[model samples]
Target chain A: MALMIAVSLPLLAALLCWIRPFRAVAWGITVACLTLSFAAAVFIASRILANGIAIGIPRWFEADGLSILVILLVSFVCTLAAIFAGGYMHHGSQQTARLWWFYCNYNLLAFALIVVPAFASPNLVWVGVELITLFAILLVGFENTPTALEAAWKYAILTLMGAPISLLGFFVLYWAYHMSGGGTLETWQGLYASASTMSPNLLKFSFLLVFVGFGAKVGLAPMHTWLPDAHSQAPTPICAVLSGIKTTVPLYAILRLLSVILASPEARIGNWMVVIGLFSVGIAAFLLLQVRDYKRMFAYSTVEHMGIILTAAGFATSGGEWGAVAQLMNHSITKSLCFYTAGAVLVVLGTRQIREVRGLFRLSPFAGGALLLCSLAIAGAPPFPIFLSEFSILSAGLRSGHNAAVIVLAILIVLAFIAIFLQVNRMLFGNPEPQSTPASVPGSVRTAILIAAAPVVVLGVYIPGPVHSLMTLAAQQLGGH
Target chain B: MASAQTQLIEGLNALDAGLILLTAFAMVATRQVQGVMRFFIVQSVFLAISAFLIGFNRGSIHLLALGVITIGAKAVAIPLVLKRTLPDDLYERREINQVINIPSSLLLALLLAIAAEFLVGPLVSASTDPVVHVNLPIGLAGILIGAYSLVARREAIPQLVGILAMENGAFFAGVAIAPDLPLIAELAIAIDVILIAVVIGVLTRDITRTVGTTEAATMSELKEEPYIWR
Candidate 1:
């Protein structure tokens, strides 16, 4: 019942947003629902730790260590995004109808994302994740600008193109399950236990298909053409959500599949993951150097971060898994902070071009300072959680005997760091371009920036007890050690 | 082996395979957008007949319904919509350029069909009836050929026809392999095709209005300009 409420509240709030009288009320309801859901996630994680078993909802849903972490992340990030939206929308001149649509879709996306990690059935999990693509398309195109519409269309087509291929993989898995006498058992645990008995060729084929299919969503190299366009074109808050959480949740789904494959005695999926991860990191790092749009530069950084996380997971060691999960959390917080600050910058300067918006320090001090700090954090500067997480991941990769992967990861990270810093420094310290007029900065924008900045700071300085325990438990479920 | 019943089944399968190959060849060779739409209608007719034959042999009521729907929707309704939307001047224009010449494309399509047959033949031969195994490759080949049509055609209507042909090919494969798939899934697939057709109709209208021509090549202006951030 709690799980149902956690999933349904966003959906209900979305419906309520359509009515004019309840528009403001709906924002409150969304925040309240997310807070309650976050509390439930924490409570559930604690209960699982105490009982040494997960909570399951028969064949459809389950809350294990890993899902608990994801649920908490989704609820936490979504709560902040909603708060940011409240202020962000309040100051805008958008119509009630448009605002309502944005809020409704935001909640609907929140609902879908929260449920992805909780599903026990692979089929239903795929359904939920793919459904998020549709919701995102609507939201990414929300502005009705031609560029936004085109990005939405490209995103929709490219992502949906993966669906049939992924479905083929799911069908193969179902075939394997049936052959192993595990029919009607759609749970990941059941499927993994019987994976060894499945045909090796089928397993490899399905793994490749599923990887490429979901890799499109993960914004890995070659298939990542849609990521920059959609991210840069989407509204700033939506950009944060997309860059921070939407991409990570799908990666989590892939991690679950990787866990199953690694546990299988017949097949080794780790090497393939490492190759893809390395390639993604290399491509994204090179592209990051040439990016002109600040939002797109950050989007490429997300691709780089995703690659790092995958590389860490591909190391297939206990420390590697732990570092990967930690990095996932850090990237979510820090990248979101960067986007929040970017949002403030956009509001004040009315431009996304890094070349045009120079000397942000002279424009609005709070926004400029927030952008600088957030850029440093995302660039893996000292005292930032991402810096620690990336270091731990590199160390874990080397400790696990993935020497080549470790070196490649380090090279890519350094290159990406240079590219990001070059662009960020130009924006921060370069001479300000003369403007005919200065845009007014809203106080709410500053508040949103602070709200977004808090998590990155707190997580860097202190890993709260409950969250740390949850991450440790989630790492164990990766079948490491 | 000498039984008339067995001979009839073999004859029907051979005919179905022949039509699949022919439609594939025609799709590659056709120059005019109207010609491609006509070929798609012919392909859909063949698909319905194949489905009807399968229904008779298997005694499945749903397969018969599927056959009727395929014929009524693909052969009749979709073609009518396409014809209505096409400009009259486009109807008379016979100048269409194939990315590859007709003869070469025909040869390529034949080779692809043979390759698909060789690949899928052994897999299905041992499990199910050998007759269904032959149809699998032909169905797959049809899908590939239709995809090629979409790639090669410059006109929007031809591309639409190619998409419809692909759906027909997929339906053939589905019926040949698993005719007993849930009725709801089949219905949903049909509805989705109709929805796609509606969307295409709208896109075609918009393309005509905006560019004054329905040629897809002209639509390339929307291609991603190297991101100039400003």
Candidate 2:
């Protein structure tokens, strides 16, 4: 029931926002709906912790440990991003008439993001993922600027093209399940159980097809051309959602299918996944060095974190699975916080270029302080959640006897770390640019960032018992043990 | 009598497959935006016909409903949505200014088709179902060719049509293999495709209004620039 409320509240918010009278109050409605949805997600997570699974409807809407983690992150990031948007969208803009539409589309995107994980069947999962992609395109292009539209177009084509390829993959998977004498009701758990009986060739083919198709949406290397563009070009709130959970949503689908594939006795593609994941990390680490725009820099960081999670999952150990899910949670929280801080700076400075700003610490203390805090957190610094998750992933790789992968990943992570700090060090400390004055950060933006920072700070030092158990259960679902 | 019915369905499916592939090629070779749209409609009709033929052979109500839904969504609804949402000038414009020329694109599309055939060869060879034998590889080819058209075309409408063409290709194979797939999934997928069309159509209109050109290739502002650290 909580899962159902978490899913439906966004749709209701969207509908309410679309009504003429609610136009003025769209932001409030969005924030309230999302906050309540987050509460429902927490309720569902707690229920999963107690029962090991929460089923809203049998064979329709279910939240296992893995999905509950994703749902929690989605709801968390969304509620905060909505709060940030409440103030950020109101900044530097006179176009209040269309603000309701932004909130409406935002609610719709939130609905799509939350629904994908709660879905039971892979077919419905595909539909959910497509809806997420379509809604994201609308949000990415919401600014209506030339660059924003181009970003949306590029984003739409690249990701939408993957739809058919993955659709074909899903059809093949269905055919394979039927060939293996499975029932008509095809769910992830059902496939995972029956995977050993399925043909390895068809299983491998479908997984590859889906991986190649969904890899684009995941912003994995080579197909990651659109990630920085869309992530940087969209409104900062949307950027938070895109980088934070939007990329994670499709990746969650990929991981679910991968879990099924891993359950099969004959299929062993973990090594290839490791290689691909490393390749994405390597690409993003190098690209991070040369990014002129700070927003794009954070955008590239999303690609890097996604690569790290994929690599961790590729380790295919229980430890690695735990690390992967932890990294997923940490990255979503920290990256969204990073974008909120970046959005606040953009609002104050009216610039995205890394070279344009100097002595940010002296400019607006709130935005500057938030930027410093999030950059440290996102760069995998100690006393931040990302570092703990990343460290566990590296140790898990070592435990899996993947010394070479561990070495490569460690080096790439360090390189990315240096790259991030190099750019941020320039912005945060230095002589202030002439003619720049201190700007006042919005109350709502400050509140959202401070609230978002709580988990990033707390989870690094302490792991709650239920959350740890949830991670363990989620790790088990990956077929790692 | 049933065997005869199966044979007839298989034979007609083979014909539809050919026509679908031809329309895919036409979408690649066509110069005019209107021409690409027409080929897409033709391809969708052939897709619906293939679904109906397969549904008849299997006597699956799901596939039959899927057939009706495919025609309603792809053939009628998508085109109507595109025309309604996008401006007339976008359709009237010619010379799509592709990345690759018509002959080269046709040649490359042919290669993509052949590649898809070989790519799906192992799976197709294992399947004893006659419909799968015909539909799977051809459906894959349709996807590859549609992807190619998407890459080659610069115009907004054709690019949108290119995406729909790929979905049509997927359904072309899906109706054969997953004929018993649930009615709800099928309906949801149909609705999702139309939503794609409607969303992309509106986005294209916005692009044309804001960017002054629907040429997606021309917009190159946001890209990686080689920056040197001083």
Candidate 3:
């Protein structure tokens, strides 16, 4: 019930906001609901961790370690984003109706994302994720600016193209499970239980279809053309949520599928995963070098991080699993912080073009400092959690006898690091651009930034006991630890 | 699960395959948007006929209800909606510009029909009804042709027609594979198709409003930059 409430509160808030005449009351209701959902998610996670049992209401709701981790991430990030939106919306020049629409769609998207991990059925889960894409299309095109609309349209078309192919793969899996006489079990469990009896050729075909289909959503190299445009064009808060949380959640679904396919002794899905992962990492790293938009550069960074996580999971070892989970958590926190800082920059400078803005520290120390810290965190600098997680992934790769992969991944990371640092340094230390009229910086924005940033910094230095155990359990569920 | 019921299932499957072939042929041959819409109406009527046939053969009351809804909503109401929305002046002129000539496309459709028949023929040949061995392939060919129509058409309305054609093929396939999928799932899929049609209609109007043309190629201004970020 708590899990369902955590997912539904935002939707409820959206409806309230829609009917309410006053904007202030709508913002208040949204914040209140988000705060309550955040509390509920933390409580649910603690309970799941304490009991070590899945809590679910059959087909409607489920919370295993994987779902719990994602719920916690969504609830936590959305709470901060809600705070940021309070300030972000106020500063925007858009009309009240437009702002209301943005808020309503944003909350609905949040609601859909929160429930996605809890769905026990793959078909329903795909529907939930597709709904998120639809919600995001509205949010991305909220400005109704031509660029924004184009980005939204491309996002909608490309993502929709992936859906039918993925559904076909799901249908094949349903047939395989039915033929194997595992009709009662739902989705992942059913497929995993019958993996040995399934036809190898059919499993391979299904996995390939599912991989390319979900891979498009994951923003892997060849299929990643939509991410940067949509991320850069969307409202800053939406960009933060998209880059930070939305991209990673779909990966959980893919990983679930991969786990099922890998359960078969004769299947070589892991090799395919590794190949795609390396390709994504190498391609994204090179692309990062040429990015003129700082937000887009950060978006590419997400692609790189996703590749690292996939590469780690592809190793299919205990250490690799742990590293991947840690990497995912670290990437979520770090990327959210990066977006928070980017939002602050956009708020202050009113531009995303990298060359047009310089010496941000001279203008607003808080925003500049946050950007520097986030850049360092994302680039895998010392004392940041991402560095530790990436190191673990590298070590796991070495231990798993994937020496060639480790070397290539290390080179890509190094190149990405240099490219990112150069851009960050240019913006932070170069001659200052002419200062324009400063927008009123909201206290809520500051608070939200602190809320999101402090975690990345704290986790970089330390991991709480419960979080550590939860990560381990999540990895174990993937047949890793 | 009875042998008599199974024979009824095989008969319904054969009818489904024939409906699918007709949908594919309609999709490939149609030129004007109104013509495509008319073909869609015909396809929906065939779908309703197939559903009613299934209901009669199996004595499944739910199938009968589905037949009613399919006929009322799809065959009657949706076509009325399409007819109202489509411009009468444009309906008189055939505006299709196929990359391949009619002969080639028809030949390709025929080849696809043959391939689908051969592919699934052996699988269903041992069933009580031999007609299913032929009908299943026709249904599969309809789906493939519907997809091909979507790919070939540069206009918004033709694409919408193609999408509807594709759904007909899927419905045909579903009847062949799992005739007993919960009524709720079937309703949901049906509603989804209707919603898609409505959405495409709205988008077409918006495009016409903006560019004064519904040709999809005009929307190419939204294409990706060669050096896309990230």
Give lDDT tens digits, candidate 1, residues A1-481: 5666666777777778777788767767777777787777767778877764455566667777788788878877887777777766666434455677678778888988988888877767766777677577777866655566556655655565564455445544554455456654467778778777765555665566578778888899878888999888888778888888998988998888787777777778787788888888898888888888899989999999999888888888888899889988889888887887888777777788888878888867777798789988998887889988999988988887888888888988999999999998888876677762446666656666787788788777788887788788888887632
| Candidate 3: C-alpha RMSD after superposition | 4.1
Model 2 chain A: worst 10 consecutive residues (lDDT sum):
A88-97
The count of backbone overlaps in candidate 2 is: 0
Predicted candidate 3 versus true structure: per-residue lDDT over A114-183, tens digit per residue: 8788776665666677666667776776666556655765565556556545544554555555556666
- Candidate 2 - chain A - TM: 0.98
Off by over 4 Å in 2: B227-230
Residue A377 in candidate 2, Cα distance off native in Å: 1.0
DockQ values of all predictions = 0.15, 0.75, 0.23
Name the runs in model 1 displaced over 4 angstroms: A19-40, A51-56, A89-97, B1-230
- Worst-scoring 10-residue span by lDDT in model 1 chain A: A163-172
Please list all clashing residue pairs in model 3, or write none if there are none: none
Best by lDDT: 2
Tell me the tens digit of each residue's lDDT in model 2 across B9-71: 899999999999999998998899998889888898899899889888888888888889988
Candidate 2: chain B TM-score against the reference chain B: 0.96
Q: lDDT of candidate 2?
A: 0.90
Model 3 accuracy (lDDT, Cα): 0.74
Instruction: Tell me the tens digit of each residue's lDDT in model 3 across B1-230.
Output: 68777577666656665665766686788777777877787877776667676666667676676767777767776666655665655456858877777778888888877786775565454344443344445555665676677667777677767766755654554443344444654565555455555544544554455456666555554333455443
